[model samples]
Target: MRIIILFLFFIAVGVGAFSQTPKKKVGADNRAVPTKNKIQSQMNEATSGIAKEIADLEEQLKTETDEETIKNLKEQIGMLKKQLKMMQGLNKNVSNMSNKVIQQAFNSETSEIPKRDVNRINSLPKKILNDGELFVFMKQTTQEVENKLAIEGKKLGMQLFDTLKARKYSAQAMGQYAFACMAGGFPEMGLYIYGKACLADMNNADNLNNYAAYLTMAGGEQYSIPILDNLNSKYPFNSTILNNLGQAWFGLGDMNKAKKNLEDAVRIYSIHSRANETLCLIQQSEGQTQQATES
Candidate 1:
């Protein structure tokens, strides 16, 4: 699934005509700061658990007489082994780096998006708007307006921008605005707005997930990986997060890691279309015709 998963930001417009604006570097002052020791400990424990599970499954395979059961056990063991390897690699990487170094690396990677300018908005006190309100506003303003040529559309865009700067919108609202910008043919602005949204609310899982997705779509998979990894640590069973992480690894040409995460995602949620499709593609690429067809 190399296609962009525009979950709710689908807009019928010619996005190709517009040249992407130069990215403005933004600081990572509000990013979800990871604790090196804690994450390492968690990964170590998870690796141990996976290793033990693999051992148990291998033992079961040894004693099982039913061919079907044996096949399932072997498959489980193989998946577990891959997971073990991934965890060990992650632990090694995390253990070798200091928290400051990790943070610096992340900041450097995500410096393309522009920082929010607090001074652009009005100074008067106003009620903070939510995502729903912002979305309605976006819909109303974008109706029948072509941002690139139409004067009305340009005015609307400025109105939207000014409104965003006018007050400290909620994180969810910022996320919505980011989507609107992207769907409405403003990729650079969308990225910038979403970057600030992620910074403002790093704890929100949806916010982080969407941000990573945007980065991956924009050929910034290297930057998305860290965020996806952190999100994975917090929500190990989230299929969407695992799928996104797998896509990022695939984008970086790490087939093993990509396969591992995609497999985990599909195993957790068999109905995940993107994960299943990607896994199938990997199998086809490797000449595993039977496996690919089955997938």
Candidate 2:
């Protein structure tokens, strides 16, 4: 019956809502049981109940044109589709948050990520889709490479290098490749990837920033000095690039200029960790450690 189907739908939704924690968060509760997974199991049960009811309605209704039966079936199908979409979205969020946690862990410990999450990330298909979804997936996968993930990230990127060999390139995809290259500690490769994207779209700031970022990261202050100067010339008041420039100046022992660039950078991006840290260092150098402490 239509009324019975509706009741089952509400029950499934209720279960999904309660079992909202990600699969990776198991053993996170005081009860030593993951509440979310329990709820997910319940949802699976309720989904089975809906399937049974739908099957019963289909068998009992003789004609496809029976308006009530047709309408009920359509509603059931729609509900299933919506739930699938919700699940996929939840999967993406979970993957992203897990990647962040892993990055922080690496920063503190300087070690490899667990093989499980690494294998899970690597399992994403190498083939990029046309719907612009592939970029997000690739980006998520690349995040596994904290400073410690350099080698694994290289392997993952190289796995798909063959896929693009004969394929027509897009700036969007190449930009993502640039990201992977940078994270993997291949600045030359990173610049090469960004260069391909820039060749496709010369004025793309995303590509330009990556180019600048790798230059700074690779050669320390020497190469970064000229690059940052040029970048600041264009985006004079841009905090992100300026912050980078300050660090370069510091590396070159240009204390006065480092202090200036860092001051402007922190002014523009008040809460930026790198900029604030660099600025604090410069202040300490200036015999103003007290001022840096206040900051």
Candidate 3:
């Protein structure tokens, strides 16, 4: 009895917090949100239909018992059950998505961030970073379609840039936007976004490190000379930075430098997975495979 009372109290507090918390906006760049009730109704209807079909099949199976017919009816019943469960889950997900969209809309209307300008995507001025509204609006949509819309990655990146530009442009925004573009499956566009981000703020160590890391991963030796010098200069002996620097040299076929940098990084952060992996790689390249073998 006491435990139940405590649970009820906790639930009441949770409800109060949610009721007081303000909602977020979907952004000036909105996606279509299906109504929760409609989705739920569809879910119920689908479930009913499937249940009715299964009942009919069961009834038929009882009367007409050919061995092969019974087997097929059992299989169909199993398939229909799975479909019904899936539809119900989808309906619940739809309702959740609707709430998120609605909250985002509310937050946007209350916040000072400018709405995204859906007009021209390519010609956005560099002054867009002054406002913080664009990412707020477009990030969700970009995530929603990016992997599925890999072919349209360039278009999405361009659109995102212009949307962000309508707010303000900064290394932070550019870096994040570029990274997002890359994540969305447009490697080249991601590189371009990183370029814009780096150009906007050369003093940003993280931006340089990450952008170079991306280049190192993509172009291997071809990109070593480009970002290594700058990264090494900026972050002297930082562990993760050193690890990446080691990787950059490794890609450029400088096995000695790779081994050296990776060793230094491991010395600083002994348990770093990537540093260990890099060390293992270096060992393999030097025919020290047995020594580097994972236990």
**Cα RMSD (Å) per model?**
23.5, 19.2, 22.0
The deviation in Å at residue 283 for candidate 3 is: 1.4
Q: Residue by residue across 178-269, what tens digits does model 2's lDDT show?
A: 54333323344444445446445544544544444444444334433444454455556565556666755655556676678878866765
For model 1, residues 102-143, the per-residue Cα lDDT tens digits are: 545433322122222233213211433244443343233223
Q: Which candidate is the best by TM-score?
A: 1
* lDDT for position 247 in model 2: 58
Lowest-lDDT window of 10 residues in candidate 3? 7-16
Position 244, candidate 1: lDDT? 82
Candidate 1 regions off by >4 Å?
Answer: 1-162
Range of the 10 consecutive residues with the lowest summed lDDT in candidate 1 = 9-18
Worst 10 residues of 2 by lDDT: 24-33
What local lDDT does model 1 show for residue 227? 65
What would the per-residue lDDT of candidate 3 be over residues 68-133, giving only the tens digit for each residue? 767766765664465456555544555565645533432232112222223321222323221133
Q: Candidate 1, TM-score vs. the true structure?
A: 0.48
Q: Candidate 2, clashing residue pairs? A: none
